[model samples]
Target: MGLLEYFRLAVRALKSNKMRTVLTMLGISIGVAVTILVVAIGEGATKSVADQVNGLGTNLLTVHQGPRQMKLTAATRNAPTQTQSTLTLDDAQMAATMFPDTIAAVAPQVRGNIQVRLNASNAQSTVLGTTPQYMIVNNVTMRSGRFFTMLEAQGNLKVCVIGNTTAGNLTGNPNADLTGQTISVNRDDYLIIGMLTPKGTGTGGPDPDDMVMMPVTTAMQRVLGAKYISDFSISCISPTMMVMAQQQVTALLRQRHHLMPPFPQNDDFVVNNQTDLLARSQNVTKTMTMLLTAVAVISLVVGGIGIMNVMLMSVKERTREIGIRKAIGARSRDILMQFLIEASIISVLGGIEGVILGVVSAVLLASFGGWNTIINPMALVLAVAASASVGIFFGIHPAQKAAAMNPIEALRYE
Candidate 1:
């Protein structure tokens, strides 16, 4: 018989057991849907991180006082603490001045938490001490007013820039013109010179829009009362110069810190480039996605088993029909093809339904759950192909068993 005849026969055979066919199809569909959903969510999360990092400029490199380490113990309760950072504002200045050709800008930063009060209202927020170069190196833009001038930074003026979230809390309106208004921090009132444009949360970090910014000199002398800097951000002259900039900064800091040959596993300071960090983060996400996808694919295996069980039962129930067809000169290959075709039809149909369900689920998650989800076309194609393959692989044994049965024995079966 022709291929179309085989499909027609397969459909008729499946129609005879409507409920079982539906259940089998449902199983395959769920597997495909889950696999697609997991992969899409994973891809979305990676993309979100990449975008956040890129927003800070791909040519950026961050130099921290030291490599941060997580300490876990019965006493510390798994809290992470940093080793005393030897990096200071002087180190920041030296790096900028020493690598003028490779580095475009350097913004040293110190951070502290403080309670800010504006008249009767009060809010707790992070205060960052940074140079005017911070706005340029970190790609920060002011929504209103202007960034603190270098002269103001040098003079240690009592001035600050409020982020969007802090502005709303202190002034009761995010869009309020707080420029030139005063907010009390550490019992010292600071004039709000500018407001920063809203920047969303960082990758696995605090919201960037929920802090206050001030000149490094003012924050050290007037607010935080500290001498050491937490970190510094450096912008390279170009993307191609990021590696050279990183090398220069590392060598400069290592020599300045007086580290001898054979640098210890834990360096006094570290320099991180944005592109390398992005790649490392993406690799982690990709591994997680693969593991989750493997779990989802197990469901497909289960669905395939269901198809096999049903097909075996089908062969027994249709023994008399099979015997009559064999009696009429039907060949073993013909019977095998018919059964295989039936299984493929079921799985392929289920796969189509699954693709639709997965897309809708991804959209719903992004819209309502506030999650990032990106549906890849390759994922859809792979899911469908996997479903079809599962059907064929599991259906082969049952099809072969039926085809190998003796015609005389099958004909006489009840």
Candidate 2:
């Protein structure tokens, strides 16, 4: 018989047991749907990290305080003491001015969470106090008004810049023209001098567009009462000078802090090239995605096994029908093809249903759950192909068993 005839026979047989056929397809359907969802979430997270990294630029370097390990010796161990921040504003300025060839700009920062109020609206937000060069080093731009100037930073002005999310939290609009308005931070009203361009929620760290920016001097003296800056960002003159810049800055910081190294372990400050850090982060994300993909594959395998079990049961239950077909001059290959086609139809239909369900779920997650999901067309094609392959692979044993049955014995059996 032709392939279409075989399919028609398979469909009629499956229709005779509609409930069982539907149940048999359930495993494959769930498997494909889960695989699609996992891949969508994984890809979204990786893409988010990549975008954040690219936005930060390749030439940027970040310096932050590292853990201070007390020296231990064979004779005696040093007593544990409170670890203080090893970096200061002076270190940042020296790194920028002393190495003009390597370092282009420096943004020393001190950050803290503070309560902010605008009329009746109240919210808690991160406040970043940094030099005006934060714009250059971080590639930040103003949507309206302007960043604080060097004169304002030096004079410790009570002016601030707000990100879109921060503005929305207080003003009920993300794109509100909050520039020139005053918002109270810790009961101290600071004039909003600028509004930053919106940066959507990031996967890597704190939300970039959910914070306030002010002059470092003002943050240290008036807002946070911080003596030492938290961290600093430096932009190298060129990507080629990253290593040289890192070395020079490390040496400068070590010297300034009077840190006698048993090499890097004795150092209380950590300097990282942003690109390298980002690459490491991307690697981590890729690893997680790979792990999740493996789990999805395992689910597919389980579904395939379910298909095999159902096909086997169908072959046993239809033994008398198989005998009658063979007795009526049907070939063994015809019997095998009939069973195989049934299996294929079940899996193919299940896969299609799964794809629809997964795509809908991904859309819902992206829209209402605020999740990032990208439906890869290639993934859809591959998932269906994989399901079909699984059906054929699992169906083979049952089809062969049905084909090999002796017609006389099958007919005699109850």
For residues 1-414, what per-residue lDDT tens digits would candidate 2 score against the true structure? 999999999999999999988988888888888889888988887787778887886599999998777665643356564266767889998998999999999999999998999988998899999998999998899999999999999999999999999999998898898988899998899999999998776654688999899999999999999989999998999999999999999999989988886878888888988778778988997898899889888888888898899999989998999999999999999999999999999999989888888888989999998888888999999989998998999899999999999999989767
Pairs that collide in candidate 2 are none
TM-score of each candidate?
0.92, 0.91
After superposing candidate 2 on the true structure, give the runs of residues whose Cα lies further than 4 Å from its correct spot. 72-83, 115-123, 165-176, 182-189
Give the alpha-carbon lDDT of every model: 0.87, 0.89
Best by lDDT: 2
Give the winner by TM-score: 1
How far is 77's C-alpha from truth in model 2 (Å)?
6.3
lDDT tens digits by residue: candidate 1, 1-414: 999999999999899889999998988899899989998999999999789878986479998766434333476556565666778899999989988889999999999999999999999999999998998898889999999999998899999999988988887887787888999998898999888998876545787888889999989888888878889999989998988988888888878876655553446788889987889989988999989888889988988898898889888888988888898999999999989898888888888888888899999999998889999999999999999998898889888988988999999999
Q: In model 1, which runs have C-alpha deviations exceeding 4 angstroms? A: 67-82
- Model 1: weakest 10-residue lDDT segment is 67-76
